[model samples]
Target: MRIGIADTTFARYDMGAAAIDELKKNASDLKIIRRTVPGVKDLPVASKKLIEEEGCEIVMALGMPGPMEKDKMCAHEASTGLIRAQLMTNTHILEVFVHEDEEEDPKELKKLADNRAREHAQNLIKMMFHPRLMEKEAGKGMREGKEDVGPL
Candidate 1:
């Protein structure tokens, strides 16, 4: 299967690279198409193009929104666009966004980005090849980059 990786230039960390590494480690039969855009707002079009034009069955949209009000707003807008793109194309585009304000330390931020991207890559694998595996984890409070909260 073909998988698309769409990332942003404004991102401080290379989450796409992390996702690619994880994907390669777990799945050997996937063809990955990478598309880099200027910022988070541009990811939707890039993902859509990857799906419709490049024949990707699924896409991973990785972005890092800065620590600011405007950045969060932009992230929301980009998310909306991603949802619209997914509905229009009938394909899955996994949105992996790590807001800069999530962690105060840069090291932690990078770790969070990498872990989240890798985890989402695994999620993509489950979506494509093992949907039942994901279903089995429902309400388990699983998380990436940090400890899982577990079920309540």
Candidate 2:
């Protein structure tokens, strides 16, 4: 499958790189396409181009929004556009974001971003080929590097 990855250059960490590495390791045959934008707000446009122009089957819109309230707002706005893009293209765009405020420690935040990115890559794999794999995790939070948490 042709997978699209869109990330923000303004992020404090390289979450997109992390996601891409995981995807390559897990599924070497996947044709991975990437776009690096300036910030979270730019991800949707990049995603649209990836889907409409590049012919990617699915897109992963990865970002690490800062702790600022404005950062969260921008993330939400980008997600809305991403959703619309998915509808317009009749494709899936996984909106994966790990906010800086999610963890108190910087190291912890990095770990969270890495975990989230890797998890999203796995999700993409399941969505494309082995959909039954997703059903196994249905209603469960599969937190990477941590034991599976029961459904909330």
Candidate 3:
């Protein structure tokens, strides 16, 4: 399985470019997928450019959670817009994290997170199937025969 991580983890650890180098070394077989930093508010324009320039196979945008009472509505609107724009580029997914606040009930928060994930998936499917965004490149690669592998 390919392992991937969001850029937030890198920023959190203050590892900067060193983290990307480490991931590349340890998980050479895994694809390095780029994701925006949470709470940054602005879309990660520079990060996206770097990911594309570096030839990372996948990218995702991080969407913020709404305030306590308006979590669902805020997430829906923010995520929908982010996903739409990210899809225009090479990003295949958007990662949304549940807010970790002491005031909210854990069970209720989990439920809301699950619902948001499902909604995001549905939106992605709808966008990917649109005529302009069709996965023709993916289909072409599948049509070409795969190379035979010798004994592992």
Candidate 4:
């Protein structure tokens, strides 16, 4: 099984890395695949840079969008940060956590989270696959003896 740890601080990074390394050394059946730096709205760039430099394969972003009155700006920031990280690294997965209010119903929150998960999954898939699709198109054109094909 592949395992990944996500957290916000540099100490967390170091501790997670060490723990993952220890896990790999002690357990041959387990694979410590990635270590991700979780992103907050104000620290997105720094988190992305840490993930890229550490060669993490997945990122989990925590977005506290506040209430309906706040306009949900932090959610947008988290998504933007995830996109930026996807572009910078080999990250294949992005998990977003939504802050819940005390008065919110669990079932409603679950449904909303499910919808958001699907939407984000589609967006991420499109972003990740579009480049590969373009490359495939170029390759097909080249194979068909078309000289106008552009490089990927």
TM-score of 4: 0.41
Error of 1 at 100 (Å): 0.3
How well does model 3 score by local distance difference test? 0.41
Comparing candidate 3 with candidate 4, which one achieves the higher TM-score? 4
Query: Candidate 4, residues 87-139: lDDT per residue as tens digits?
Result: 66655535444445512776655545444433443333334435564455544
* lDDT (10s digit) by residue, model 1, range 1-152: 99999999999999999999999999989999999999999999999999999999999999999999999999999999999999999999999999999999999999999999999999999999999999999999998777899999
Residue pairs in clash, model 1: none
Q: Model 4 segments beyond 4 Å from truth?
A: 1-4, 7-39, 99-152
Model 3, 1-152: lDDT tens digits are 22223434312222223334544543435555544454423334533453455554443343334455665565565556556545665565445344444227756555444444344333333343343543433343221011224322
Error of 2 at 44 (Å): 0.6
| Regions of candidate 3 where Cα sits further than 4 Å from its true position | 1-28, 31-40, 43-47, 62-77, 99-152
Provide the lowest-lDDT 10-residue window in model 3. 141-150
Candidate 3: give the clashing pairs: none
How many backbone collisions does model 3 have? 0
CA lDDT, every prediction?
0.97, 0.87, 0.41, 0.44
Candidate 4 lDDT (Cα, 0 to 1): 0.44
Q: Which stretches in model 1 have alpha-carbon errors above 4 Å?
A: none
Tens-digit per-residue lDDT, 20-106, candidate 2: 998988886888999999998899889999999999999999988888889989988988999999898999999988888888988
RMSD of each: 0.7, 1.6, 12.6, 12.5
Best by TM-score: 1
Q: Report the error of model 3 at residue 22, Å.
A: 16
Model 2 TM-score relative to the real fold = 0.93
